[model samples]
Target: MSFDGEQYPGVMAPPQKAQGFRLNHTMLRVKDPEKSLAFYTGIFGMRVLRRLDFEEMGFSLYFLARLDDDEAIPEEVGERTVWTFQQRGLLELTHNWGTEDQDDFAYHDGNSEPQGFGHICFSVPDLEAAIAWFDSNEVSYVKRPEQGKMKDVAFIKDVDGYWIEIVQASKMEGAGR
Candidate 1:
């Protein structure tokens, strides 16, 4: 099951000497921390690992992750900050002060014209249950599992309008068969 660079033609292999590399987190600028935090924490079930505020810069960073049941979190703030960076697959929300008060401020979701950043994906244990939960929560959907060519996959919008792809790996295993 190991990766074979030959599978991807013309893709160069990584340097043998390179080490200790991993994707830490992806950041998205949010207009309102309250709404964004609620959507991510409440809807997605992600816990706020750490919140860093900069009074002088008029901004704050909220790091969140879906932790496993056995995962141990440090009690101290300093220790937790160190621990948060060590984990993988984290989402960071950045809120600039006063943007929420402007009444017209918003970030480009990158899914419209001239798209760049596509979407963040979440793998769930039960696709049907997840979709039902989303429906109950009144979450806006771009695509449902049954509506598109790609079956067993769905896309929903966050409060900030960022697309979040929902997938259940077990169901997707039989795709294209």
Candidate 2:
């Protein structure tokens, strides 16, 4: 008698697979949400997607997106406008009110040398061009592209002293040669 797979009663059922999740956003606690927002929006060219004020919690949250174009919309719908560039990713800025002692608060101290949790990274099309732009703007950078195992990595700091890592994906393969 031929044994069919379905006819075998002793066979156990297959295990279920878990669903995958994608990265949504990274949240950072800022000393001043307004100031942080201005740096990211003004210098980095990010747009405010949404802003929520939690008076009860004494905290405010602002969602920002990096947009390609710098066009301004009407004041009425400006806040709700969805910038095209942020569709790729987003940055979430959180501000807690009534917190006077920021010294004890956990925040990225740009004053200190680059150590653990160095900076946020962004992939760029042209590394040389980006570096040139940084030079023209008088922005200081470490210029260590791909130190150690991580190649094609460049470091720069924003106006607020937050470190930024610029990476060129294409050059990563031949990096450190």
Report per-prediction Cα RMSD to one decimal.
Answer: 1.7, 9.6
For candidate 1, write residues 1-177 as lDDT tens digits: 985655556777777776777788999999999999999989989999999999999999999999887888999999999999988999999999999998888899999988999999999999999999999999999999999799889999999899999999988877777
- The lDDT, on a scale of 0 to 1, for candidate 1 is 0.93
Clashing residue pairs for model 2: 146-151, 146-153
Best by lDDT: 1
In candidate 1 the C-alpha lDDT for residue 20 amounts to 75
Top TM-score model: 1
Which window of ten consecutive residues has the lowest lDDT sum in model 2? Answer: 79-88
Residue range with the least summed lDDT across 10 consecutive positions in model 1: 3-12
lDDT values for all models: 0.93, 0.67
Q: Candidate 2: how large is its RMSD?
A: 9.6
- lDDT at residue 137 of model 1 (Cα atoms): 99
**Model 1, runs deviating above 4 Å:** 174-177
